[model samples]
Target chain A: MKFCSVCSSEVKQRIPHGDNRLRFVCTTCETIHYENPKMVVGCLPEWQDKVLLCKRAIEPQYGKWTLPAGFMENAETTEQGALRETWEEAGARVEISHLFTLYNLPYISQVYLMFRAKLLDLNFSAGEESLEVRLFSEDEIPWDEIAFLTIEKTLRQYFEDRRKGHFEFHIGDVERRVK
Target chain B: MKFCSVCSSEVKQRIPHGDNRLRFVCTTCETIHYENPKMVVGCLPEWQDKVLLCKRAIEPQYGKWTLPAGFMENAETTEQGALRETWEEAGARVEISHLFTLYNLPYISQVYLMFRAKLLDLNFSAGEESLEVRLFSEDEIPWDEIAFLTIEKTLRQYFEDRRKGHFEFHIGDVERRVK
Candidate 1:
């Protein structure tokens, strides 16, 4: 931060009074600014054995297919964020299973959490953010059209684990950029 | 949204020429707008079997103590985000255990994810965002000084679970406010 939040004075990364390492310390307010990344949580809704995917009606990754995901709401858990996003984007009720895949993109400064979810029913319509919403069997997935690399990686890992009957966890950076 | 991102014209929520629920439907552009929330992740780092805590150096709850937390960076996993925050604020490394707590607060439009982390070591110092940092035994926790309600609740639940050896999982704040 260029200015201090407390006193509005110029802030700089300087050594702490008695420490050697650098810190974002404000000379006037004598405080440091904190930096944090944003969170994205969603679900991979499944029915029988097929997975749910949504076609984006918006930009950034328009028309691309993806699992429902969005930032966490103020009063929600990671799972609720996942379920709520699924409902809003896919019009589906989902019961979340175990913690599923976690995709990291350090360069973007964001983390994407996807839980394994069971599709409660097929009742759904185009979500405000979706151009199309449907379930895809393994063979029906539009792998090339997936919106983000993290989603592609997560889905790939999920399928691999399913094939191996292994439910081990996975975490990696599609890019190391901090969001 | 009444206006389409593509056409920049008014859109209708109801299905055109039919009875259906509301959605962001663009007539001219034929595109929908989708908005999603961001995610925030953090960790509960423990040292010598005691949890480490940081006094907030910023507001919303300035001066209150909390487990170190920040939003997920562009491409970090929830676990990575949690671990990063702990290390940055406390100058400590840790081993992340199971995700012991998940809270979704829709009112504020954010989700809080917390993992049980064992402090690999306690050599720590205050980061820029921390006014002070220290390890607290279970009974010595400074309950009222915590920065967020989720932190307090997470600690209480952690202690209880540790007591019962209840390593099983269950989501928190299904109905109550996440904060």
Candidate 2:
């Protein structure tokens, strides 16, 4: 940050008293601006043997296929955020089952929380942030064209767990990028 | 936020185009400052049949007892953040086992990720942000003097799960207060 959001004064990167890491400290007000990782909540909406996917209509991988997800907002639970994203991105209603994946992407400062959910009905369409939305069975999934590694990993694990006749929570870190 | 950290200009809250919720948008620079929930990483540090707790020396519950936790910083994983907090608050090294509880405090825009951990050695003391640190068995816990509801709930669940002989991951929301 170039300036302090609280006082609008210039900021310097320095470790504060009793802290180990460097933070943006304001010159005038001495306010420290701390940035933390964000939670990206989404769901793997399922119907019969298929899962819902949205084609992104925005930048940073536009037109790529991804599970319905987005940055979680305030005043909502993670499951609620996942449901909202599913409804908003794919216009689909889903009944959330359980949290399936907790992938920490330290490089991007994001934690992806994906849930296993059942689609309520066939009444679905592409929302504002999606160019198209469709349901694909395991055999029909466009695995080669998936949007992100986290999504790919979650999808793979979901199918594997399904074949095993039991579902379990999975947690791991993703270090795909160095920066 | 009153001013934009990017350009040091005044920010106004408005619903940006294509977004349902209002955001702090910079009028002069047209920058949208999105605020998301942050992760508070901590651990239930165990030594034999007892768990460690810290008495806060900081504001917002100065003398109340709590598990060692703080906001997850950049360039670190959730587990790392929890370990760092444990070492910093209790001056104890711990071996984290598995994530035990994921509590969403939506009212305060924070998510608490507590892990199950084992104390490495007997060399432990209170850190700067803690007035005192002590180990307590389940029956010896100070149930009335707990600092936060989430911490209390986590501790209760941990003991219950232990009694049941099966520990499972927990995810829930806490709406104690509003901003």
Candidate 3:
């Protein structure tokens, strides 16, 4: 940050007292501007032997198949965020079962929290952020055209856990490879 | 936020196009500064049957005991953030087992991600943000003096799960009452 939002004074990057990392500290108010990782909440909305997927209408892999998800908003639980995202992107209402995957993408300072959910009905359509919305079975999934790695991993684990007859929570890091 | 962090221009609260909530939107730069819930990552550091706790030296609940936790920083996994908070607040090293609790405090726009962890050794003391650091058994816990509701809930769940001979992930909300 070039200027402090609090005082409109020029800020400098420095380690604050008792802190180990450098942060944007205001020159006038001396307030430390801290940036934390944001959570991207979504759900795997499943019906009888099929899961819901949405085609992105926006940039960053537009038109690719993805689970209905988005950056979480304030004053809501993670499950609420997931349900909201699903409804916003796919016009689907789902009952969340449990958190399925927690993927940390440090490269983008974002954490993806995907929950297992039950699709209420088939009354689904493409929302504003989606070009198309549909259901996909195991063999019908667009394996080659998935949107993100986190989605791909969550889907794979879902099928695997279904086969094992036991679902478990997963937490892992997905780092961008240096070129 | 009074000024747009992007352009340093005065911002006004407005609902952006295709969105439902009011956000700080910059008229000059057309930047929508959206605020979201942040994650507080920490762990229940266990050395055998005892768990580590830190007496806060910082404001919110100064001198009261709590688990070592802070805001999850950018470019770090939740587990890494939890471990770092443990090391920084209690000067303890721990190996994380699994995520134990996910508590949503909607009033404050924060999510607590607490994990079950194994303490590495007995060489630990109070860090910069802590007044005192020590281990406590279930019977010796300062139940009435815990710093936050989330911490107390996690500790209570931990002991209950331990007694049941099974540790499971917990997800719930802790709402703040209006005065």
Compare the candidates by TM-score and give the number of the best one.
Answer: 3
Q: Where does model 2 sit among the CAPRI classes? A: high
Model 1 accuracy (lDDT, Cα): 0.73
Off by over 4 Å in 2: A177-179, B177-179
Task: Return whichever of 1 and 3 wins on lDDT.
Answer: 3
lDDT of 1 by residue, B1-179 (tens): 33443444566665543313345666666554333454557888866668889988877788989998876554456787788888777777889887767666555565677888888866788887788999999989988677787778888888887789775444555344344
CAPRI verdict (incorrect, acceptable, medium, high) for model 3: medium
lDDT of 2 by residue, A54-95 (tens): 999998779889999999998888988999999999999999
Model 3 residue runs over 4 Å out of place are: A177-179, B177-179
Which residues of candidate 1, in runs, are more than 4 Å off?
A1-36, A55-64, A70-81, A125-132, A164-171, A176-179, B1-40, B55-65, B70-84, B95-99, B126-132, B142-147, B164-170, B174-179
iRMSD, model 3, in Å: 1.0
Error of 2 at B63 (Å): 1.7
Ten contiguous residues with the weakest lDDT in model 2 chain B: B170-179
The sequence of per-residue lDDT tens digits that candidate 2 reaches over residues B1-179 is: 99999999999999999888899999899899999988999999999989999999998989999999999987788999999999999999999999999999888888999999999998989999999999999999999889999999999999999999999999888869432
True contacts kept of each: 0.41, 0.87, 0.73
TM-score of 3: 0.97
Which candidate ranks first by lDDT, i.e. highest?
A: 2
Cα error, candidate 2, residue B15 (Å): 1.9
The docking quality of candidate 2, as DockQ, is 0.84
Better of 2 and 3 by TM-score: 3
User: What's the residue-level lDDT of B102 in candidate 3?
Assistant: 95
The alpha-carbon lDDT assigned to residue A27 of candidate 1 equals 73
